[model samples]
Target: MYKNKYEPALDIYRRTLDNQLKLIHGDHRDIAASLSGISWALGYIGHTEEALEYSMQSLAIQQRCTPSYHPMLAHTLRAI
Candidate 1:
């Protein structure tokens, strides 16, 4: 999705992320990664508000679950 710049990729990312969240348990780092991808896709597709919500969710998860200096958290912070 990030590499190709395709708008339809947002829908695919959204569906996959939703399914991932349902299957994953607890505060998993993989969920955060999925959220970040969804947020990025939303932003690219011009859904700025939804993007921000997902970004915030991803950041919150990272802050709660990952190390303070984790690269994933840093990446999400940059996105926000």
Candidate 2:
């Protein structure tokens, strides 16, 4: 099933996000990247609301930490 295929990926993304949060004190590109990973996994798993939330969070972090023209920001925007 689609859920079975993506569930493991979602779990990994969540764990990675947790680790990134613990290691990084504030908004960082790594954190944003983790969030984006989670968002992608969640979206594939059919958790659209949560996916959008994570995508927004990632976008916010990217906007704050990276240049406005950063590829990551553009990616997050497209994801949202």
Candidate 3:
């Protein structure tokens, strides 16, 4: 039941990430946010390894694009 709920969400998050990657040329906050969303969905679906990977990717982007004290960086770190 839980898996059923998260699976569709996971698919949507993946599609969003893909679209963001296509539309945006470089590392951007929106892409990082999308990656974070995908990470959250993957974590909820028990795909912890994949979730961690996405989370780390998000963190890296956030670090590069955002200030050191940015809230998004903290959020991504927490997710990691």
Candidate 4:
């Protein structure tokens, strides 16, 4: 749904991302979710390398802050 409605959905997602990033700009682990959003959007836009890079970055951050078996960590791992 979102992938097909990029123009409209993107603003909403971008706003959400801005808010979250504002709260945890330098906290890589805390901003894993936002990073995931970026990766998702990049993937939807066909930027495979950028998407994978962001996914890996998010995965690394989550691994550092959460347990290895955490749900978000799992998602990030699979995404990469």
Global lDDT scores for all candidate models: 0.86, 0.89, 0.89, 0.75
Task: Compose the digit string of candidate 4's lDDT tens values, residues 42-74.
Answer: 788788898898788788788778887799888
The positional error of residue 16 in candidate 4, measured at the CA in angstroms, is 4.5
Runs with alpha carbons beyond 4 Å of true place in candidate 2: 1-4
Q: In candidate 3, which residue ranges exceed 4 Å CA deviation?
A: 1-4
Give the worst 10-residue stretch by lDDT in candidate 3: 1-10
Number of clashes found in candidate 3: 0
Output the TM-score of candidate 3.
0.89
Q: By descending TM-score, how would the candidates be arranged? A: 2, 3, 1, 4
Worst 10 residues of 4 by lDDT: 1-10
* Whole-model lDDT, model 4: 0.75
What lDDT tens digits, residue by residue, belong to model 3 across residues 38-80? 8998898799999999999999899899999999999888777
Q: Candidate 1: minimum summed lDDT over ten consecutive residues — where? A: 1-10
lDDT of model 3, residue 73: 96
Clashing pairs in 3: none
Q: For each of the candidates, give the backbone clash count.
A: 0, 0, 0, 0
